[model samples]
Structures are given as structure tokens and as C-alpha cells.
Target: MLFGAKNSSNPRLQLLKDVVLFKDLSMRELAMVDSLMHERRYLADEIIFDEGEEGQGLFVVLSGRVKIARFASPLEMLIELGPGAFFGEVALLDQSVRSAQARALEDVQIAVLFRAEFYSLLETHSAIASRISFQLARVLAARLRQAVANTDRHHEAA
Candidate 1:
């Protein structure tokens, strides 16, 4: 099946249930989010976004996989994202350039939300903004905790 082609009654609703960023949203809020986002499909090996490029929005993986890579001194594999995962969130929050490159590892379908649309939606729906802010904070906290844990592990190894 090609990415973004699903048989579900409501693909956006299904996505909301699967993605942490949207899990806290109500049905109405989900519908709002659905309206602001667009679905796109990419073939395997396609470049979703290149590093250092201006990031317009974030992408939620609907199906297939993606690899997040960076080039520092030498090329490095940062991480791989699968279904229900998201990337480019930092750019959404700050409107900065992307810190890494994302490439499709398989035929992939993704839901993308542009910064202007997202901010406009948030302005129109305060509850949706609250929910998204809460989720983003949680994600950031978790990542910080993970970084601390990794640092401790490295220190212990040394």
C-alpha cells in the first residue's frame, strides 16, 4: 500500500489516537488539527528535508519509516522514526532551521502542519494550544531526562 492511502473511516482520528502530540485532543480538536494538516507520501530513499534548511512545520509518520541523520565531522545516524512518530517540532516552536536531515527509509505517508496554520489554529482554539503545549513540554522533559541518564552512563563507563 502506498503511504497515506488508508481505508480507515477517519485517518486523522486514527492518527490522533496513535500520536502522542495529538492524543490529548478532543474529537473536535482532532478535526481542527486534521483540517490544518496535509497528507503527503514519499517513496523510499526520498529526502524529506535536508539539514540546515528552513523548517516550516513538523511531520507525523502515518506509515513506513524514516531515518534522522546529521553530518558533524563525519556523517552520523541520529535516530530512526517509525509510525506514530514525529519530527521537526523544534522548528515549529522556534521557526529555526532544521538541525538534521530526514530521509524516507521506506514508502512513507506523513501528515504535515505548516507553522502559520498551526499557530492560527492555536489562536482560534485555546484548548488545542494548551493540549499541544502540555504535550510538547512533556516530550522536552522526557528528552532532558534521557540526556541526563546518557551522561551518567558515559561517566560511569569512563
Candidate 2:
């Protein structure tokens, strides 16, 4: 019901509406966010962004899969994302370098929301921005908790 009474058009809009970070956004607010989006495609195995590179914004997976991995001493894999998933959101709040590398697991399509545009939305649409920011904070906190739990388990095993 959040994406508009279900229609043939706006599949991308519907998909984004279901995504966690965008769920609280209304259809109109989503359209405003959509206006700032630009689509890009990548082939399997292509590097979408490299670890240590500057993160410009959030990358929403529209189609296909993405593999997020790190290049540290252990070279760990962070996550694999599919349609309706998003990453690089921290960059929207803090323009920091990426902590992991993103690669296309297959031919993929993504919608990119640039940082400047996101900030502009935050200024002009505070309500929508607050919803998204709250969601982002929740996700970050959950990830932090998971990491701590994993570390505790590792120590116990050791």
C-alpha cells in the first residue's frame, strides 16, 4: 500500500519501496528520491567500487547480485546483495572511503543515489530524510551488534 495501490508501471518504485532504507518513504517522497537516481549496468565479475575508494553514495541493487568483500589480511567477504538491497549508505552521512569492494556477481543493474542529491533531499524534505536516517542508524546498530557477537564467539572458540 505504501508504493501506491499497485500498478503495472513503476516496478522500480515498488521495488525501492520494499527496500529497508526506503520503506518509510511515501510514494511522493520516493518519486523525489527517484528523480536523483541514475541507473548503471555491470557485467559479471566487474568491479563496481574498490575498497579504499571514495564512496559517493548508496548503490541500490535493481537486478542481479553483488558481492561485497574486503582486501585485508584475511580477505573476508562482507556480504552478497540482490535485488532490493542497498549498500554504501554510510557515505551519504559521512563521505569516507569504502571499507569493502563491490563486484557484480552477474550482469547487474543498479540505481545510484549520489551524496549531494541526498543532502539536498535532507535539506528540502526533512521528514523523508529523518525516516531514512533513522532506518540507517538502526541497520548500523544491528550490524555492530552482529560483529560484536561474532567476535565473542571467535574468542570463545579460541
Off by over 4 Å in 1: 1-9
Candidate 1, clashing residue pairs?
none
lDDT of each residue in 1-158, candidate 2, tens digit only: 77353333556787788889989888888877777787799999999999999999999999999999999788788889999999998898887999999999999999899989888988898898889889999999999999999999999999
lDDT of predicted model 1:
0.86
Q: Give TM per candidate.
A: 0.89, 0.89
Poorest stretch of ten by lDDT in candidate 1: 1-10
Best by TM-score: 2
Q: 149, model 2: CA deviation in Å?
A: 0.9
